[model samples]
Target: MEGVAAHQKRKVMVVADPTRESAAALEYALSHAILETDTIILLHVENPNAWKNPIGSLFKWPSLPSSSKVASSPSSEGLGNGAASLGYAGGGGGGEMEFLEALKRACEIAQPKSSVQTERVAIMDGKDKAPIILSHCATLGIDLLIVGQKRTLSNAILGHKRSGSLRGLDTAEYLIENSKCTCVGVQRKGQNAGYILNTKTQKNFWLLA
Candidate 1:
């Protein structure tokens, strides 16, 4: 049983999305399960393209400047810095307050366990999702990926909306089919947690908040 538990402590990487439930699922998985893994990396990707305003397309100026130009200027540097501030829930952390609180709680709970260490990474601009995630996972020698599966009739029928949820659709499916490591996807059912075993691993491990 000791060895079994030790083997189960494989490194888990949870990719962070802007969604609330995804963040909550990561918080729960880190606190409840993967404390024994080699490491838990919280990866958050911020897509600059997502923020591009359509209004900027209306004018075709002769000398168009990049966002970096505005961001680097002395006058706009403060505004840039201010806009990127991390917020906290208790009016201390900034924009990332909720995330920081979740991480704090997870860390506190994980302190008693000596199996895994946690690290958080905020990716500012990554265009390719699956390759970047897989590259990072490989670089870290990750054994598992724990992600939240949004439960719905549509998702159930059509599968994850992210094209390739964790790995690319094909790679993710292959992992579910062949990878030695497990991929656990959790779905929220009211206050309870329901999970899907995308791999040969165990299914439906309930969390006792």
Candidate 2:
């Protein structure tokens, strides 16, 4: 009975990057959605350009093994030791490393560090960020996925672009529309005010902070 109950907790995956937008998504998850029993997965994707050298880049993190599912509550001690083992091997990945660490700090600030168990995953970005992210979500059986989004001028007026534009497919937009699980695109409203949320069924839904 204990094992079955433990396996039922929700799994929340928040895409983490150094951008202000990414921070807002993390903030939204921590503030409004997460619960005490939730397991947080912080996923950081590194652009190919950011790597410079694929073989030696410190940004490369091991991919999730094929057999893993989203377990209910991973051990806090194990998470700590695993993170410590993933130290940078001296390269140009400092900035990316700092990004995930900052997001983790946000997690800790929201919930007592001892109570919130978290996992960190860094992946090398492929041609399209959304598809790779979607694949991982499926692999992990994530319950909720959150990614930060900035409302572009075009999107604000025409909804989101239907196809790849000069800037390519909007990752957050694609995820919100297509991810298998419930996916949220959170946009912070300036430096204050509140937030604008986009989901599969809603667009520009405002939530006053």
Candidate 3:
């Protein structure tokens, strides 16, 4: 089986969305991955409606501010240890900025110690996302699939009060059931902790700071 296969370099795919849950998942994957050389792929599925806007105004990359603006702005040195630096122009439309910013945050979290090669892919939503993710896993020989579990209205109504494990999102569940590689669902645990849920067994493990 693909999950049991031993490979020199492991490729991990993170299904990234513009949500705090997704950021938590990426942070968990980057921080806790066993291997330092793992290749992390950030995948974002774009909505078709995002392309309806005018290309010049909506899709154009914002120009960098002048040196005067930089000098006048407050220093970000005290923001944190590895605060995200946003200077480059990202591709795609307005929604693409969110994905790029998320990716940048993930990169900042994995800095200094981690030598993992990271890449990002923005897929145009011409078809279903589950199939695309599965195909990408097969083509790239992904060793593990990581995704965030966002709470829905149903989850909020019926709460995860039982305490065994919370159900994952549709995309995470689909990939967990059908993907060729191992799948992990990450959920945010309050402000400082992260809960890593195993997809197959539905077991919950806490990663506390």
Q: Pick the candidate with the highest lDDT.
A: 2
Off by over 4 Å in 3: 1-7, 50-98, 101-126, 152-169
TM-score quality measure for candidate 2: 0.67
- Candidate 2 clash pair list: none
Clashes of each: 9, 0, 0
TM-score of each: 0.53, 0.67, 0.61
Candidate 3 versus the native: TM-score? 0.61
How far does residue 28 in candidate 2 sit from its true spot (Å)? 1.0
Give the distance in Å from residue 142's predicted Cα in candidate 1 to where it truly belongs: 0.2
**3-54: candidate 2 lDDT, tens digit per residue:** 4354367878988764567767876776677765777888876664664554
RMSD of 1: 13.4
1 or 2, greater by lDDT: 2
Candidate 3 achieves a global lDDT of 0.55
Candidate 1, poorest ten consecutive residues by summed lDDT: 59-68
Displacement of residue 40 (Cα, Å) in model 2 is 0.7
Query: Which has the greatest TM-score?
Result: 2
lDDT of 3 at 167: 37
How does residue 144 of candidate 2 score in lDDT? 91
State the C-alpha lDDT per candidate: 0.46, 0.63, 0.55
